[model samples]
Target: MQTQPISTIAFTVFLLLFSPPRAAAVRPPPNPLRSSCAQARYPVLCFQTLSNFSNPTAKPLDLAQAAVRASLVRTRALSAYLGTLKAASQGFGPRQRIAVSDCVQQISDSVSELSKTLNELQHLRDGTFQWQMSNVQTWTSTALTNGDTCISGFNAAATTGNVKLELKQRVTDVAMLTSNALYLINRLADSVTGKSRSNSGN
Candidate 1:
């Protein structure tokens, strides 16, 4: 067999050792929100609502925060819409007016609860993980209840008007969003606590 010259062999070895590493195949980061939301009840809505607030590499806590923020926006919008309906209550009959008033109050309560949930989520590091997670879960649950109460007020009253139906429809959507957010928050809480336990074990 013919042997390569020493200089040629040495140059080839040098190139092999120093040529810029083939850039490791740059993989796009996995979309964390999309993956998590895929398991949500309203997968499409959850993903669409949250994708605007997160990047592909967001962690569970980040995705949970995004979900809370989205729910807050929906609650605030519902509150404002209810306020408008309340303002035009002059045209409503006594029963309809009562329903509108109740809806306005309930929606306002939902806004408050959602706000609290967001605050709790932001301050998760202020307390024990379980305690903070419990507060977030409670507040989100209350917000969902408030949305249901707003819709139920219309249902209980003998109001067959379009306003009642419209308000119910709108609040229903908010309730669904709240429910989805709560699910994400629960998942995040569990994941965070699990990681803490695992690290402590190590």
Candidate 2:
């Protein structure tokens, strides 16, 4: 075998020493929206509702905001539907009319509360995060309660009809969406605050 020249050997050694190692293929991070929604009670609903938004790779705060906005959209749609039904049922019997009117009002209130929650969430910051999150939580809870109240109004008045049942179901569905949004918001708040404290500790 022929031996390489000294210069060649030195060059080979230099190449070996300075050559970059083969990089392992890195897996992309899991979809944050899917990961976060997986923690919700209504994971499918949470995912479907929020996935419609523009960004899926958003941070926790952004995801929470998106979820709240989606919830608001749902609540507003439900409120509008209730309003139409209430208007059409103007000549309905006293009990039915009263029930429908109450439902409209309750769903409207829920929409308002959800809108407020969204507003609060939009302004959340690391410094006043906890308090702001608390307000968001309270508003979301109230929105959920309002939805339940809307359904209860129909039940209390013993209102029955295809329209009544449909409205109740729709309101319940919106309320469930709100509930899932609230869960995501709480989780995001905890995650962000915990990470902030951890970084501070270091």
Candidate 3:
């Protein structure tokens, strides 16, 4: 057998013992927005509406707040548009004018409900978490109901023409946004309840 150099052998052993092990594989962090929207009733719409929302912390409450705020803004805009229709009343029949007036009121109520929801979410506290979440859910649902009422008023009035179509479209859009917001708010409530149960060993 050929003899190997002792120095070379020792150097090889040193390299084996001292070389850094291969770095462990790194994994990307979970996407908060995607995860939040995954279980929503309107996941795609929820994601799109909140895609531009600023949520660096990625907290559930932040997402809920954003959703409610978006609904509130849309409701306010729709209410304003409805007011114009009610005021002009030029082309509208008497029934349509009444429907537009009713819708304006309904949308105004929706705006208030959404505003309340947003406020509750913003001020949510651990001590009153359940109570606050209940209020948020109720208010959000009320807003959605108000939107439905607006549409129903138009239907009952037998409203026709562009005004009817335009009001229905805008109200429907607000209702969808409000519905998504309510869904997210309920999800947040569930998450909180689960955490509470876990902490108490229930």
Candidate 4:
């Protein structure tokens, strides 16, 4: 007979002595929002943002819309903040002022794009699902691109370091939300298309 190591036997005894009941060790029930958010590029942010409105009955399209709405809300708030910065830009260097102004415009554009995406998602029709989903994809992608543009505008050497850092962090947050929205939208489109194909086959 093989002899077990003392440490191994001791560890086994420790487990038996201290481990919780089997029921307590069982995995917790799955969260639908967590499951849905896993499909996004930023799953943690996605879950956090959607948790405010997510329900047990929320479907893929519902989650996508909620994500876009969250992005839109954040973008709009950032746009307002940028407006204040642009107004108080007298203290900034000429290049910094220009960068701030441009960032404001870029964020404004992002707001518009996200608004369109949310609208399209809300009114999605099965008859034109593909066409409408294409529009949503384009708009969401544009929104993300606009945020990137805003961040790039601050890359000039003349930009105020603190302002640049703050704007970058805010824009990055909105961009992550938008990116997660796009991921969910794309997943919704793929799932619908797959089902259509399966139905046709049957």
Candidate 5:
């Protein structure tokens, strides 16, 4: 029996069978505003050595540092729940608003302390500032003030998605400010060290 010539339809079928499957769609990059944040360069200075927050005798630096860390914890907590809240379209009333506002107040107080730390850190330019480490006192005060401002701003905001979005934006700003304060503070301290070394050689 003579073999039938391959038909066009058969050829088309064969080609389709050999073709590779399409790849999954690639995701777009995240929005820049949300993606960017403070460089994770941790601060390495003790404002004041205190046992704990319960001890009112602790130095402001220690107290302030504790406060910032606490605020960050709250941030994490809220971030975790925010997704669920948004998904359910859950509407928080005045009480929740007040709670968030309290958080904002805490942030503001922390920022104030950080700013003060920057100013005091600048004084680290002096060798004498090495001892007592008291120069950073003013800086601690400044940081506390800014921290308070940050917290207060959030608390004062209206209870709306728009307001919440604004609060999120402020978080980024606070992170950036914290990074800057730490960087400048270190630089100021370095300047003092260089001066000390120079004077010793003279």
Candidate 6:
């Protein structure tokens, strides 16, 4: 009998199905702002707009403007990453083929969820910083999966194409965006909660 090789993936999938989803430890929120961050987002285009004619390192006039810039930064990085993935899937070696296919699956899944979260982010900016937080968490996991896929693809192929190299670069870009998004989410939350405390004290 030609039995299938034991795969960590099969085992992991089985374990996930059986085990309970673990929850993160709850923490107090930050941000002293009265308005919510749910609708806060970076620009749909790049960070620059008629309202943002100068350097982004300089202060944005309002919270929404700051958010639009942040979202654009994240979006540009994500677009760059996808470009890399398209490039990496170019080879035909048995190993390379397998590796690239795995990356494609993960990248596809991650992007699908990312799109959903982004749509939600664009809708409102009230008490929904939780959505922003969720986007970060999802992206972090996606990056890990994409990274593993990239390494595996590289190992299987003797030589990489421009495309393959791009995939690796994308993993880098996505990780950067994930980290920055989380920092903003935390800071914004803290500011919100701090303001709430102050008003209560007053």
Predicted candidate 1, C-alpha RMSD: 6.3
| Per-model RMSD to reference | 6.3, 6.5, 4.8, 7.1, 17.5, 23.3
What are the Cα lDDT values of the candidates?
0.83, 0.84, 0.84, 0.88, 0.46, 0.51
Clash count per candidate: 0, 0, 0, 0, 34, 27
TM-score for predicted model 3 compared with the true structure:
0.82
- Top candidate when judged by TM-score against the true structure: 4
User: Per-residue lDDT for 99-150 in model 4, tens only?
Assistant: 8889888889988998888888889898999999999999999999988887
| lDDT ranking, high to low | 4, 3, 2, 1, 6, 5
Q: In model 2, which range of ten residues has the least summed lDDT?
A: 53-62
TM per model?
Answer: 0.80, 0.80, 0.82, 0.85, 0.37, 0.47
Model 4 ranges off by over 4 Å: 1-25
Estimate, for each residue in 1-202, the C-alpha lDDT of model 1 and write its tens digit: 9999999999999999999987788888767677899888899898998888777778888888888888888788888988898898898788778888887888788788888888877777735778878888998999889877767777777778687678877888888788889999989988878888899999
Q: Where is model 6 more than 4 Å wrong at Cα?
A: 1-91, 124-136, 139-149, 152-163
Whose TM-score is higher: candidate 4's or candidate 6's? 4
Mind sharing the TM-score for model 4? 0.85
lDDT of 3 at 26: 90
lDDT of 1: 0.83
In candidate 3, where is summed lDDT lowest over 10 consecutive residues?
A: 52-61
Displacement of the residue 108 alpha carbon in candidate 1, Å: 0.9
Model 3, CA-based lDDT: 0.84
Better of 1 and 6 by TM-score: 1
Q: Is candidate 2 or 6 superior in TM-score?
A: 2
Once superposed on the true structure, which residue ranges of model 1 sit more than 4 Å away at CA? 1-30, 200-202
